[model samples]
Structures are given as structure tokens and as C-alpha cells.
Target chain A: MNLSLTLTINGEQREIVLDDPRVTLLDLLRERLHLTGAKKGCDRGQCGACTILVDGQRINSCLALAISYDGSAITTIEGLAENGALHPVQQAFIDHDGFQCGFCTPGQIMSAVGLIAEAQADGDAERIREAMSGNICRCGAYQGITEAVLDAQAKISTGKERDAA
Target chain B: MNRFEYVRPTSIAEAVAAAGEPGSAYLGAGTNLLDLMKGGVTQPSRLVDLTHLPDLGQIEQLPDGSTRIGALVKNAALAHDPAFAEAFPAVAEALLSGASAQLRNAATVGGNLMQRTRCAYFTDPASACNKRAPGSGCDAIGGENRAHAVLGWSDHCIAVHPSDFCVALTALGAIVEIEGPAGRREVAMTDFYLLPGDTPEKETVLDAGEMIVAVRLPAEAAAFAGNQRYLKGRERTSYAFALASAAAALKIENGLIVEARLALGGVATKPWRVQAAEAVLAGAAPGKEAFEKAAEVAFAEAKPSGDNAYKIALGKRVLARALMMAAAGTPERMPALPASPFAPLPEGVVNV
Candidate 1:
């Protein structure tokens, strides 16, 4: 039973024919589309290594079936750059050294982007830390991650302010 | 995960009809369902995807002042909704407290209500869990169960329902709207979850082919908006399930409690609501004395099912502390750590 679906992934429209209904969104991105930036640390939902954006909201892609997300716009780690320039969050992570092993960096950056867009972090360090609790960095890079999120949020908000002005 | 037929229903009637199949299951967000499926705990023949259905993704304020939250509404969306947060602060706090931001963004309200136990025995296919395989046996009773249920647990099963949102909803007297083969009906949140009696597999009051359409919070439940809190005690500061938790709401008039609602989580098979404890708090001054008495009444029938005797004592303290926080009044803004015990107490509020 082949189920056909279309996904706007990383600003590209990709048509997919899924032969298995059990294929998760993470597997589809990493295996079929070769979007290996989104790592699969834990196939279970407990780990946020497979976090991605579906219609601008952050979700654990490992637990989401590909067939269930038909026609939805998805954004992964590969989508975070513009014109080969790093996204603010990605730049901020590099500036603050937000990772060590880097296995969880892609998910961390994607989740940070989603968090900043949600605007619930309010540029507060504690709020950012709480919000990013889902994306675990086993290397204990949370201090840098939190700092990076705060910095990126400030940069984004200032950019918005500049745009409005 | 086992392969299954995926059915996307455009209408509630269609979804219900498709779910009427012998081995069909209603799939909402698939946060819990897919996880359980991958773990080999449950294998359904077909999944009726309910995310496509219209009108189940809205949060509506009815003319009668009650709020109707769609079953498909995401947890984060509902919690961040200013009107909902202002009206049902405790519920919002509870929602924010459970899981991480990513999970909250994908997990639906109905999925949260329908989530199974976090019991290791239940999730592991090798273990003999009565809740997972009915009449098989319960390994949790004699296993490592420091996190097991302490109230309303039977010999058949001792797994606690792991939802902080349900804790607050049980206290607010939320009503679950259901669509089933027989037609539409409503069940109070307090009665929606069933205790693990002899039929441990039957977790909720929902029958076969029934789907949760929406959950309604009556207008009266908003009365405690000013003085309500959901406090969770966990091993970690964040992103962990509760060791024990309590939701406390009070309506104070002339320095006396007119009505109080209290419920416990992580300590029972269901969100444990003790009306007798509320009766103890009624007309009493919102003080440490009254709160302590209420906590005692709340845990009157609680007994540890395993090595969880500490949960009963911890649960009582959580209830008392939550009552104190509620008496201190809801915060002007949500705490940085929404429901964590480490969140700074409101001014003039002392520790329990």
C-alpha cells in the first residue's frame, strides 16, 4: 500500500510515496531525503535529537509518522541557512560554543529556532533554559546553549525592531 | 514499529465509524500512540488519523462563559493562549509543566488525557503488567516501584496515570466531550479515568469506538483563577515526571475559604480528587493549620502499593505547599519554571 504525500521541506517541495505507514518523519528526512543533519539519537520521543519544525512549531519527528503529516510545511536543520549564511541561532551557537560532540547540535539549533519564533523565551536565560530542556546535549553544553539562545533571541528581536523602524 | 493501515477521516462521524472496526485506533498527533506502538506495547491493525478533521483544533469561548477546547488543540498552543492562561491559570501551568516544549507542541489535548502510564513494567513488553496485558499479572507490585501509585491502586495494577494536565482538570471539574457509535455524551474529568480495579486494562471510561471531541471547563471553574496553583515535585528541576504533585484552588470570602478544590497526581491510578479534603477546607481560614488538616484528609485512604511509602508523605506536603501557594494568589506572570517547586514563592508566602 503506497501512500503518496507532499511535504514542503527546507523550502523545497518534495513528493514522497511511502510504501510503509510506519515510517516516521525523522526516518523519511534522514533516510529517504538524505537530510542527515537531523540526527536520530533515540528513536523514542524521550530524546529531542530528531526535533524539527512542522508549520513553524517544534515537534519530535521521531514520534510523528510521515503519512500523518501530509501537506504540512516542515523545516529541519538544513533549512536554517539563508544564501549560505548561518541563521542567527546557528551563528549564536557557534559564537557561544553551544556543543561539543555535535551529535545533538542540529536538533538543538532547530529547536532553538522554533523556540525563538515561539517568542515565549522573552530573552530570559532561565526561560530559554527551560524551553530548551527537550534538546539534550549529553556533553553538558547547556550553559553555552542557554547563552546562545538568549543572544539569538536578542539579535532576532533587534532585527525585527530595525525592520519595523 | 509494526506496519498498519492509515485512515485519515475528514469528519468525526467517519472517524468514529472507521474506529468501530475490531482493531482500529483513533490517532491524535501520535505522540503517545506511536511511541507505544514502537515499543511493541500495543499494535493496532489500523490508525484513524483525527488530525485532519476540522473544528477539532479550536479553542472557543461559548456564550455561557464556559471554554470549549478542541481535542486536537496542541498543549503548547493552549497554554500560551493568553485568554486561556488567564482564565485557567492552574490548567495552563500544569500543561506547561508536563513534557518538553517540543512534545507539548505536537501532543494534543486528547492525547494527553489518553496517555498511558509511565510505568517501566507496563511499557516493557517482557514484563507482566496487568495494565498492558489484562490478567497477565503485575510486576510493579513487587518490582522497583518507588514511583508507583499510592492511592486507589488494586492488587491487579498499581500504575499511576502520568499527566499533570489531568491533575489540574480534575480539580477544576473539567468535562470531557465524547463522540462514539452510540452518539455524543459528556463525562466529568473526575470520572473519565477509571481506577485500576480487576479490569486493569480498562484505564478510562471511554468505550470502544469513542473519540474525545473536546474538553469543556464550566464557567464556575474560573472562579479560582485568582487563587489556584499546580505544584509538581520531581527528581530534576525540569523535563521530568512528577514524584508527587498537587493542584489546589480556593475561593476565599472574608478571609474564609468558601470552596476549595484539591487533587493529587503521581500518587494514584487517576488524578486523585478528595472532596472530603475540600470539605475540611470549606469555611476555614487559609492558613498552615487548615492546609495541613486538608492534606491529612486528602491522604486518609492512601497506602503505598510498593516501595512508595515516601510518596504518601511527599504527596501530603505537596498538597499543603500547593494550597499555600494558591492562597498567595496566581502570579502576575507565569514563573520562569512554570510548576517547579524551585520557582520563587509569591511575596509573603512561606514554605510548607
Candidate 2:
């Protein structure tokens, strides 16, 4: 059976028809949508290398089926930069050197962004750490990543919502 | 992912009916299911997504002073909800302890409850596993038993159920509400999950064609407000399955324990509840010795498998520490437990 779903991605309403269950949201994003920022590292949920935002929540797109997410709003790394300006968390990653090989950068940034949003909504650092700990970077860039997230949090917490916009 | 049918049902009854087929599973947040399908671990013939169903995504308060959390509620949402945090702190803490923020955002309540074991044998098709393929034989019994269960394990299988949040739900007297072809029935959370017993393949009491509509946690009066704690000893600070963990609730009045509830995970095949320990600490002082005695009560019936005896000791520590932490809660703050003696961090407990 086939199903057609309409969703908002990168501020554009897009309709996709899915039937073959083999195609995941990750597959659609990489192979169909042509947004390859969310990489496929360990296709297993063990690695958060394919993280993205589903209605502003960080999720492993590789672990999300395209057909299941028919009408949900999605945001990817490509959507993080508006008017060529990187999102605060992404900028903080650049400033803190949060990545080495950069394979897990997109997922890390997406998870970090979610953590930062959560912290601003009243979560602490330990809570944020627990939340962001799913995206693992084998290059051992955790310290820098945590620092980047904390750094971005400090700015976002005290800054204006317009920055997020 | 093999080609299959997909449906987005709008109500619990519809979703339950759709999922009643031979190889059909309801899609919650798709965190575990999508991974399994992609990794070739689970290949369902159809997926009936429940997220689009409005009622399944809500968390409601029952008139009987219980919390009804929809199956489609995201793990992140459940852990952050104020009412749930107060009534079931162990649940929030357990979810926080299990996956990283990113995964939790995608993980749903039902999917979290129904996640498959992380056993290498069950995942690796080449490796024989009776759970994945009944009568194929479990290679994990003797072959790499490190991450396998210590208690409730038989020669047929040693894989552990991998849900940190479930242990807390078990201790807190939660209930599973399922809508099946037979009709709606609420199973106590403690009984919803069963030990591997002789059938390692059957994990829960829910039958086929049944959909978990919601999980409800009942309310209880408190001694200075009942406190809950979830203590986990995993491979590291993040993103690893628990090695041995405890979910405990304690009601202490004037340094005397009035009521206690304890559940252990990782060491057992199911969310292992300890009624004996709960009884042992019912009237004792809320202190280390009281917790130690309670731990003894729970471990008395435990049978550790080969190479996993360490879990028996670790499970005791987790219980004792969680007990103390819950007992230590003040009128203001729910206390934090001591760190576990086992730290497999900086070292690979399971391949990252």
C-alpha cells in the first residue's frame, strides 16, 4: 500500500508519496530530498550521526520512517542557517571546535541545539548532558562539544528570541 | 527495509485493529522500530503510525488520581512533564539515564517500553537466538554473556529487556492500558512485563492485535511527600544500556521508613520487582543498614549466570543506594543517590 504525506520542511510545504517501506526519513533526506548533511554512520540507533529536528525536537532521522512522519514538520542542518547565518548552536560549535572528523557534526549540532532549547526552557547542565549524550562522536570530541553546547546556552538563555527566529 | 504497507490511524481502537496482523507493529516515535528495520533486526510487514492520532500523544490525569500517559508521548516530553516528574520521578530519571537528548526527542513512550533487547545474538542474524528465531538456540547463553541477564536467565536465553524507564514504572505501581480485539484491559505495570521464563520470545502480557493505549501511574500519600530515585550503573555517563540499575520509592517519616518500593533492571530478564525488600523496609529506619537488609531480601532469590556474578553485587549496590537517596529526600529537594562503584567509562562496555 502507498500513502502520500504533506509536511513542512525548511519552511516549504512538500508532499511525498511513500510505498516501499525500505526508505527511511534518512533515506529520503539523503537520496531524495538531497539534503545529505545528516550522515548515516552506524545505521543503528547506537550512533546519533543522523540527528534532525522533528517539530523542534532532535531525533535520529535514520530511526524515523518516511511514511510514519507524513505530516510532521522537519528541520535539518541545511535549515539551521537562515539568510546564510548559522544557528547559534552551530556557530558555537564552530567557535568551540566541537568536531574533528565532522562526520557526526550535524547530529551533534542538532542534539546540542535541542539541549540548548531545553535548557533555556529550564533544564540544567547535568540534564542537558544526559539529553545530549545520545549523539556519540568517536573522535572523542565530547569536552569541546559539551563546552560548545554550554557556551551556546549561555548566549541563547540571555539573548532575544529573534536570534532563534 | 523491505517493502510493506503503512497506515496512520487516528484512534487507539483503529490502531489496535490495524496492528493485529501477523507482521504488523504500531509506529510510535519510530526510534527503536526504524533502527531495527534498517539494521535488519525487525522486519514488520506493516506499520500503523500512531503519532497522527491526537489522543495517543496526550498525557492526561485520571479522576482516580492516576496519570494516563499516551503511547505516542515522546520520551523527552514524558520526562519533562511537571506532574509526571513529581508522581513518577524514577521514570524521568530513568529516561534521562538511558539515551542521549537526541534519541529521547525521537523515542516515544510505547516504543521505549517495547524496545528489543540489545543482545548481539538477537541482532546478528548469523548468530543463533531463540528469541529472534525460536528453536534456533541462543548463542548468548555461553558465547558473549557479559551484557546478558544474571537473574531470570535460563539455558535457552540470557538476553535482558532494555528499558530503563520501565523499572521505575514497575516500582511506582503503574498500569498498562491496552486496546485489543478482545477489548480494553489494564494490566498492572509490574505484571505487564514478564520474565523470559521458558519462552524467551514472549516479552509481555499483551497479545497480538493489541495496542498499548496508555500507561498510568497511580498516586499515593507521602511521608514528607513520597520520593523516588532511579540509580543506574552503565558503561559510561551516556548512551549505554544499564549494567545494573535500581528504581526505588521511599516514604520516610521522622527517620522511620513507612513504605518502600524497589525494582531492579539489567540484572533481570524483566523489570524485576522486589516485594520482599519492600516488606523488609516497611517499618525500618531509613538508613544504610535498612537498605542493606532490603537488598539482601531481593538478592536472596537471584541466580547469577556465569561471567555475570558481578551484576549480583552491582544490583545490590544500586538498590541500596537508590533506597538511601529516596529516603534522604527533604521537603524541598528529591535527594540524589551516590555514584555506583562500577565505572566502565573510558573503557568500552559495549561497542559505541
Off by over 4 Å in 1: none
**Compared with the true structure, what per-residue lDDT tens digits does model 2 show for residues A1-165?**
566778788888998886576677888999988999999988766788898888888788877777777778998889988899888999999899999999999999987777666653243545455556678889998878877887888787768666676
Lowest summed lDDT over 10 consecutive residues: which window, candidate 2 chain A? A119-128
Per-candidate RMSD vs. true structure? 0.8, 4.4
Each prediction's total of clashing residue pairs, residues at least 3 apart in sequence or on different chains, is 0, 3
Model 1 chain B poorest 10 in a row by lDDT: B343-352
lDDT of 2 by residue, B1-352 (tens): 6666877777777887788889998777777777677667778888887878877788887787767888888887887787666666667778767776777877888888898898988988889988888888988877878777877888888888888889888887778888899999999977887777678889899899887888887756222235667778888856778898898888777767788888899888888889999999988977777788899889987776667888888888778877766665522332222133332221211211
Cα lDDT of model 1 by residue, B292-338, tens digit:
99999999999989899999899999999999999999998999999
lDDT (Cα atoms) of all candidates against the true structure: 0.93, 0.78
Docking model 1 quality class:
high
Q: Candidate 1 DockQ score?
A: 0.93
Relative to the real complex, the DockQ score for model 2 comes to: 0.65
